[model samples]
Target: MSIDSIDAAPPATAQTEQAVREQALVEEVIRSFASGGSDRDREVMNSLVRHLHAFIRDIRLTEDEWSKAIGFLTRAGHITTDTRQEFVLLSDVLGASMQTIAVNNEAVGDATEATVFGPFFVENAPQIDIGGDIAGGAAGEPCWVEGTVRDTDGNPLPGARIEVWEADEDGFYDVQCSDGRTAARAHLFADKDGRYSFWGLTPTPYPIPYDGPVGQMLEHYGRSPIRASHLHFMVSAPQKRTLVTHIFVDGCKYLDRDSVFGVKESLIKEFAAQPAGTPTPDGRDLGGREWTRARFDIVLPPAGPSTATATKTS
Candidate 1:
């Protein structure tokens, strides 16, 4: 019964083989996927195997726990639909999507930082004129938003295209409009001088939809589902870079506690109440009560042409 005989046992190559068998089974399932999928499918599946195996090894996972995890993922997949993406919602809540976006699109200089688009971005938004209000007839306080697109050198980058959209006063976006299409959702490109402006009613803070499994997951984790009041922008330039960010409304209670953790101090802007005679460029009367206005200048990095070749010096 010597201690040396117990701790000096030989390595278990058989146990390592069993672990490989389990990992191989997972890869077999993934390899059966057919067309229309990207090449990253295999890459992701392989990486997933390594990480998942590592997790199991770290926890010494039991069969019961593994079965429970499988059931949870199955339910998450079943809860997905055309309008609702439970998977994307899961990614957002876990900060995976934000991390992925940041890794792929590293912002240089003063360019805006991109965050998760969430699961509510809908394609084919209605194109509206300059200075048009996308807020529709929603009853909320008026807010004027203006901004210019410039390069890192503080010069205007003309002809930049800026796509804008936001939730209504009720925190319901146009895609979320169960009835007819709402007027508060529109896309407007920048003016010739790289300036883009628009008017809209202030968006209200609202809890994300809690009728689904994602909601249940949030509640189980003791988390709230409220996002701060802000406007979404996707700005792109011809030769420069593109940006996806939010112009956060000032004094929002949820600014510090955005459900997705998307609030940035530099992104926040003042939303002051303006007078009735605010000379609206589009002839829309934002009069009567006071309105909130914010102006932000976006800066994009230089183009990719100069990325190659070193400069010759004496």
Candidate 2:
């Protein structure tokens, strides 16, 4: 008998009645959300319910398993606070963060591709001059980073703001330090020619603070929690899209296996070794010890128009 004809007819047994009831339950829950305040919210919730109900039906999840999942989420929320963001970390390791960024920010004419912003970014980082050192004596071999920001047309984008942050040689960010003073991170501005230079440290592989629930989950899956060595940058300019990205060290040990899956071929960079006493691009001496030099050029995209411009364009 056809399934539709069977549904139209009266249920013949307890099993059939339960199956109809289960299907009705899914639809009833969806209908109950008609009062959601916004169309977007209603649409999202409706879609979520459909998928979740289908998944439950397909998997036939047990009550105990569902309860455990709820407990896990509750714990994730409990551990999340001002300094620690367990939910973002959870999204990151699951590759959801990168997927969302990719879907939302499609490429813009060869502009720099965006990536996951990780959980370490801090607002209001200190501003450093073009040739200044942002590392502030963090432990690692010195590395000089020089780059320029420009548009796809090769025109320099002067006055762009660059925010940078990275872990020290020991694989700890300044925020993780006991003193709470920022190190190895600062804000810098592109000069008139769109060039920027800063003294930082060479990238080093490190674990992603894996003592939390996410770590426990990784352990369960027998996965390593190592992230590749990389320096993070967020560049912004008026009328241009802000870019959040990272420059991966060419030979970083965990490049192929970054815990959060943030590595991209376009972002990999070579950290060339420089002999002592070599003159830097800004006329500073590389003094006495071997230092690394890496050059990364950024390409920004045109931003969406402001209200006035949008109105005019429309």
Candidate 3:
């Protein structure tokens, strides 16, 4: 039967004999998982089974719909690779990534808020010295980014490692390119005074990779894949909580509706525009090309036990 016909049918009646059987089945599945497993595993599985059964009951899910979902997951698995993670994209668009981040990173006094760690981050990114250019050879207007790493008590965090990466003007990360070239990504350490600066591209709004199953799902739901203009940052220091976040462009139109729901009001900053011939911080000549500058002072919270529970933020 067609999906239209199924939808047009009357809703199933509750409290029937079949409904009691369904409830027993749910309990049986939960018991199967609860029988033999680690405490954490059993806890998670039991809760998952309960929620899954509840969702199936709430929607009165059709067999065809379940098959279609399995097919979509299979397609996502097929497209995922070392360079492309379609499952991560799926989690991102559904706000699961952001929700997970929110649960893990609790709010500390005066500390920078955490956001999504996007799928594009690669291990062992090239290291750059302070005041170096992270853009490498990416195609975009020049931007001067300066920042200081400090702890919540207002003490500088020297030797902190900062990993920065972003898409180019066309909204494609280095890994997305076909030539196996790496640009627009690098890691640098804070100076003795906890100061670090680098040159990168001006932030621009870009669509998350949408040529896969997630894209098709978004289209089916009438949603856009465009993300807010932002630069990714992951900072870590000894004996301090690590932070993975972004500094979004203040005036980006998509800030309110980022595809991943990663934007936080505290993370937005002004990218002050400079006319051509504006002297850069390091006095590097831009050849009369206009550029922008932004300063982001990062504050890391003290490393300690998590005070928050793993609750969904969405």
Best by lDDT: 3
Give the Å error, residue 111, model 2: 0.5
Give a tens-digit lDDT track for model 2, residues 1-314. 43334334433333776767867887799899998669989888877776677667656678999998888888898887766788888888998888777775678788998787877888888899988998876888889999899997889999999999899999998877888778899999999999999999999989986787888999999999998999998888888878888999998778999998889999999999888877666776655777899999999888753101100000
Winner by TM-score: 3
The window of 10 residues in a row where model 2 has the poorest summed lDDT is 305-314
| Cα-lDDT of candidate 1 | 0.69
- Overall lDDT per candidate, in order of appearance: 0.69, 0.82, 0.87
Q: List where candidate 3 sits over 4 angstroms from the true fold.
A: 1-12, 307-314
Query: After superposing candidate 2, which stretches have Cα over 4 Å from the reference?
Result: 1-19, 283-287, 305-314
For model 3, what is the C-alpha lDDT against the true structure? Answer: 0.87
Against the hidden reference, what TM-scores do the models get? 0.80, 0.88, 0.92
lDDT of 2 at 69: 88
Whichever of 2 and 3 has more TM-score, that candidate is: 3
**Clashing residue pairs for model 2:** none
Output the better candidate (1/2) by lDDT.
2
